[model samples]
Target: MKENEVNAKIKAAQINNALGFFILSFGIIILFAMIFTETFIEHMTDMVAGLLLMTIGGGMMWKAKINIHKLKLNKTNDNK
Candidate 1:
């Protein structure tokens, strides 16, 4: 891959990984707070919200992986 594309791919991967971890961590925080707060209704709502956040994060990671794969394929084709 070109230098710029390579850098872009790496940055995208890092951002995606960071976002995913953040989502997962936020989910954990929600659960922890629920345990301490004793607000059962709010607790379940937080859990569902957390799940949605993590799902979005997972999608970001998947997109990054695909972009990286495409970049690699393009590089290989360029070499040929």
Candidate 2:
């Protein structure tokens, strides 16, 4: 891959990782709040929403991690 292409991929991976972290953090916060706060139990919808957020965030983070790993592998192969 060209230098510019490699740089672009690196940047993309960084962005994805950052976004994944942000989302995962929020999801964790929501999950914790749901578990600890009594108000969430009163509103079952909120609990469900929190669960959904957690699931989606986890999935996104996993996907981003996989993408980063793939990029690193490709970069190493290119170097070899």
Candidate 3:
């Protein structure tokens, strides 16, 4: 791949990582808030939303990891 392509991929991956971190953080906060809630219904709702957000965030981070790994492999191959 070209230098510009590599740079773009790196930038995209960084964005994904940042977004995922924020989402995961928000999910954790929600889960913590669940501890202070007064009702079982609210607790269950928060649990579901929090878990879903965490899962999506984790998936995004995982995708970023794969992209970075692929970029590294491409770089090594180019050098070889």
Candidate 4:
């Protein structure tokens, strides 16, 4: 109900989304790799897209984790 709780929930949601995207992106690359073995360029593109998605998702997940940790600490302090 309070600010920290709300923020923690939001950050948790964001983390879930980032992770989901990251996993899905890899799944796409893997599927394409099998389907495009004859095309080197297509494989490269798939790898690049997968890497980009992973980088972006990782950053977002890191930010969410920091926020979640801060919220947890605040909650702990409030309880004490």
Candidate 5:
């Protein structure tokens, strides 16, 4: 891949990782709110959804990291 393309991919992966962390953070906050607030007891479904978001976000982050690693490896190999 061209240098510019590789750089773009790297930036995209970083953005994805950041977004995933943001989502995961919100999920944790929601989980804690549910645990501490009696009012949230009636919304178990929402809590479960939050957990799902956390899972998806984690997956996104992991995938992005892997992609970034692969891209870096390819770039190095090209250099050699």
Candidate 6:
């Protein structure tokens, strides 16, 4: 791959990692909000939404990690 393409991929992966963290944090906040809820339904809703967001965020982060590792491997191979 071209140097520019590699650099772009690195940037994109970094952005993806950041976005994943943001989403994860939002999910935590939502879960925390459940503490103030008075209704069982509201609590369940928050739990579901929070868990969903967390799952998506974790998946995204895992994908980003794989992408970064692949990029590093490719860079090393290119050097060889």
**Local distance difference test values of all predictions, in order:** 0.74, 0.73, 0.89, 0.68, 0.87, 0.92
lDDT of 2 by residue, 1-80 (tens): 78678778778877877776777777667766665666745557656776777777777778777877887888888889
TM-score of each: 0.68, 0.71, 0.91, 0.58, 0.88, 0.94
Error of 3 at 32 (Å): 0.9
Q: Write the per-residue lDDT of candidate 6 for residues 1-80, one digit (tens) a residue.
A: 89789979988998999999899889989989999999999999999999999988888899998999999889889989
The residue pairs in collision within model 1 are none
Best by TM-score: 6
Cα lDDT tens digits, model 1, 1-80, are 48687768778777877787777677667756665656778878877877777677777767777876877777677878
With a 3 Å backbone cut-off (N, CA, C), the pairs that clash in candidate 6 are: none
Q: Give lDDT tens digits, candidate 5, residues 1-80.
A: 89889989999999999999998888887767676655645469558968988998899899999999999999899889
For candidate 2, the lDDT comes to 0.73
- TM-score of candidate 1 against the unseen true structure: 0.68
Error of 5 at 31 (Å): 0.8
Could you tell me the lDDT of residue 3 within candidate 2?
Answer: 64
How many clashes in each structure? Answer: 0, 0, 0, 0, 0, 0
List ranges where model 1 is wrong by over 4 Å: 1-3, 6-10
Ranked by lDDT, the better of candidates 2 and 4 is: 2
Prediction 2 TM-score vs. true? 0.71
Candidate 3 lDDT, 1-80, residue by residue in tens = 79789979988998998899889888989988899999999999999999988998888988998998889789789878
- CA RMSD of each candidate after superposition: 2.5, 2.5, 1.0, 3.8, 1.7, 0.8
